[model samples]
Target: MERNPWSLGWIVLMCLFVTNRARELKVEQVGPDNEAVYNHTLATTLVEYASAVYISDMTELFSWTCSRCDGLTEGFEIIELIFDVEHCLQAYVGVATNLNAIVIAFRGTQEHSIQNWIQDLYWKQLDINYPGMPDAMVHHGFYSAYHNTTIRPCVLNGIKRAQEIYGDLNIMVTGHSMGGAMASFCGLDLTVNHEAKSVQVVTFGQPRIGNTVFASYYSQLVPNTIRVTNDHDIVPHLPPYYTLFPQKTYHHFPREVWLHNVGLGSLIYPIEKICDGSGEDPSCSRSVTGNSIADHLIYYGVKLGGETWGSCKIVMDQRLAKFGSKDLGGNFVFSKNPASLLQAGSETGSISI
Candidate 1:
């Protein structure tokens, strides 16, 4: 076999690129005092607000507010949009005055479309640059699809309206599952592109968004991010940390507030841990069981009258059926076919994962 000099040089360049990028991965552990920063009352309230927007009719949400938290009815605004071909995406943006802060919450996955789940697997460079920040990359499909819809403009409009009424209050972006992933992106966008200050993102069962580079950039850019995960929620383990493809690498953000014994009533005491900021922290969800969809469904608690109960599971079930079976676990089934796995590893030039 004849070896081409040009091909050898190209291989060397690619190896150097991977090496340099690998050096950039760093996870910083936070202090236990950081747990004090997370307010259960506020998180529960925001989760309720985020869950409410999942209703098909905004009036139902309004009625619930009138019945439960009458104060929310005064300064609450809801914006919903369906984008992408076949209108597969159903995203809602809720701007409300809560906890003395302006909350902008995004609704999570409502309908189960193979197309939408595939979007979760699409990873690429965000290609947008921020001042004093590295070039951030993200799930290309989610980022593009979100901007394609009216969600962006609607959120901007909502923020503007909130400021007009609330006068420079703190802004919080939150959601659950897929909505949480979007919330992370939206929060970063608000701070980087729109110059919105004091933006805090608190998400539930959010999957890994981007590779190490994107995660690092996001952690640095949006330092006040809090990602909440239930004991065995499977959504947070998605896009698999160990994969044959490099571009497909997915990582979670830092400042994780993990809820163990989620449905165990008063016995459930949420543990707040500062993740290594690296997406593949062994101490986090990735190390635990990766197939607990039921855990993802219930955040705070499951029962109707249970303390810290949030209707996310009930609301999500009403939106889509076959909740437990629609698993992303198949994405990692390559081990069953060693020949195909070997081929993929060879093509990618590096199979470190």
Candidate 2:
């Protein structure tokens, strides 16, 4: 039988199409069943508390001890403050006795120094040993600042003290912006290196920490990490995923809990998406428009009403009012209205990612 050239071509095309479709249908299943599972009520409460802690750390006028501190949820009391002069990192370890959880909240960029921003710019390599796991390399600056400074020791000591007093409570590590990055590092370190059990990390508006390998390693070690990104947040897109320089390649973790706005006013809900756990998901924040800072500031604000709203903004507004607009070493500038702080900054502040 003579095969018709056109018929043969059609057959070949059909085969190719079928193969491609099968590949597409082969979904890349990543992580466990409960990997990216998020509890709306729990996440809202935790993030709100974390944001409040950040605001408290940023503004000295509103002490952490203040009962009416904005976003200061009841039950969680600050036990210790961790500070690193060289790294310019500050965090507080708080205890929620009723919940049996210890919250380690990191302070985001503040008015004192641009060290956090400077750390973001350092994308070099610094390898570390991970026992019973793959050898991992992280952001050089982040690792150095985290390792060299007393931050880690202070945190570990705080956790130890808490464990001694409370007896094996859950450790919840959290932060916003630069603090988020540090939170990620601490979460991974504590889980993999220190063998700290039941460590849950929830970061807000955090930037990418390391390369693909580091992300995968961190994801496997700390599966419960939930990165919360607001709509069009500029910080999450930082340190460029696809840079001309080879060493500059960075990736995010697998789980992302995105807070999407329903309408104009404070109505928002979280939608959880699980990537391949490889950190290179184009569908995540890496592909979004990198122009909005409003999203970062309003993480736990009233407009997005829930347990988390209005507290962070209240503290921020108070701080800004107390200290007028100056180069607070952070990116965004403060205005009369805390919400306006997000809208006031030049988009150039965000490095091209």
Candidate 3:
């Protein structure tokens, strides 16, 4: 069978288009300090724990009482759970006894519905700068959600408490989608302000959080940042990264692990591509059509968000029955003095940023 000349020409033109795009993108390789390697086991494990944070009962999470958290929290000790009423943000800090590390997981906007988050991304609301980084301009809403929310103080309190109790262990910060954006902010906060020793940030399906300047400054601040995006995951494409207008467009920080299917026909094979240090590598997920919202829900066969995992409201089983209201969540002891985390203050973990 002879192929049509028109079809062959079209294929050649498409190839040229792809090749030109790749050449235009800045695909820089990170230095040894960046620690941008992908760890399959770790990524899978962390996402599960991140999903477990969706447990609505703050008390259950603090006590490590939720059955949903059982698989993820086997050796993890829940320290604090913050459900910010005003902004509707949920996050929790816990100590992984096995790893001897402090894990901070932020629950994404899935509570409100993923569509709302995606629709909000269509706006071009850029903020001025990220604290000390004067040139780093970020998304206004993401910056405020992290810096201005009640979740900030509560998270800090939790980290401080963990430090006081267990000493300065490693900090692993992670989340999915909107949670991922917050995770990046939290990692930066721990790095500059808190004087945290070791901080690692891994986010899944995270949107472009800031402008080009902000992405650079964030890389310098928190070098150990990994962004995982699935093929056709639309969130990463939002606020739109324009090659010609990068300074004005929203950009992501390196490095990104793109999960894509390379299978032919019905074979259905998937691969994890650890992209170049440039967060906007054109050859990676940026090469595909990012229009599938369905691709945003799963990473490494781990289904995240939606009605399937939303039934933890009752929180039945052994731990809940064991505590039974007598033991309230006193895990994180907040200090009145903003500087102090070791010395106990009021039970209320609220502070202005």
Candidate 4:
């Protein structure tokens, strides 16, 4: 074995060549083209809506300010974005004549607030701290239970205090990510309980909760709720499975009223029926299911410019057990343009997983 040093050198060179080729192959497997992460383009498209809502809320808040009005006040409320410790939630608040009470509660979950918090704190660039770094950190339900529980009550209490003092004044609820979810829940509660028909909610990237029964209950309970989910925004499609099925009911709005398809219906069926079979390998199957769901939520929203009311409406008709439908795209929201990505998905693969 020690006879030829030249032979040993040849063997080492051959090993190095093989290792280099293997490395290249692995890179290809995880590269952008093969294992790429699809982002939502809806944010940009829906910025106008976001800005409009923000401005409208601001206008109303400003109108509420009365320097001499006994309980009225005006100032920037510092929101400590808990998800990203660096930034704080800053809002232009016009407190109506309620010096001794809390009015107009602003609530949200983690994804909404955290992202805003990070942006506020300018810490989003530091997404390198984790293993998957930014992408590996799954942001399905941005804020965990701790954040949700803590924030929701504070917001409710603030609203209660304000309502008590202001008597007939209005309550405006809003949030970006998880904050949006918190706002939605609070709005749902207020509307359901008959606290106020004036409860206005404007949320971005909001998640789904409860079951169809809950959805229906809220629809009846809170009609003024306006949730704007950007095309393919994944965070909005949460509360994945309906636990109490047979007894529980489901509710879907008119096609022209929904914000996005949400991918919940389409992706769930395929993932559960096909990819998640016994014959498939565990890892591959899981990836297909997870990615498909993620793709449905995020990419679909992104593609549709934060508008899915029409698509969702169509999906609802097909998905509902008893509801009979006449046409698929009859209530379609946007103009059927060939250049639109949403249309492209429908023709080829659909925005579902």
- Tens-digit lDDT track of model 4 for 141-171: 3323313334344344445444444455555
> Which candidate do you rate higher for TM-score, 1 or 3?
3
Candidate 2's C-alpha runs over 4 A off are: 1-34, 55-64, 67-72, 111-135, 243-248, 262-278, 302-353
Candidate lDDT values, in order? 0.55, 0.58, 0.72, 0.32
Best by lDDT: 3
Rank by TM-score, highest first: 3, 2, 1, 4
Q: Residue by residue across 274-334, what tens digits does model 2's lDDT show?
A: 3444455566665578667567667745221113322222223233333233233322221
TM-score of each: 0.63, 0.65, 0.77, 0.35
Candidate 1 vs. truth: CA RMSD? 20.7
| Candidate 1 ranges with C-alpha deviation above 4 Å | 1-36, 62-98, 113-135, 243-248, 262-276, 302-353
Candidate ranking under lDDT, highest first, comes to 3, 2, 1, 4
Tens digit per residue, CA lDDT, model 3, 1-353:
99887676667656644643443211122345655556666676688777777666544455555555666457577676666655667787878876568899997774455776688788766766777787778887877888887778879988888888888888989988888899999999988998886888888889888988888888878887789898999988887888898787888889888888663334444566778777889989899988988888877766666453322232223323222222133222212222222323344343221
Among the numbered candidates, top TM-score falls to 3
Superposition-based RMSD of candidate 2 using all C-alpha atoms, in angstroms: 13.7
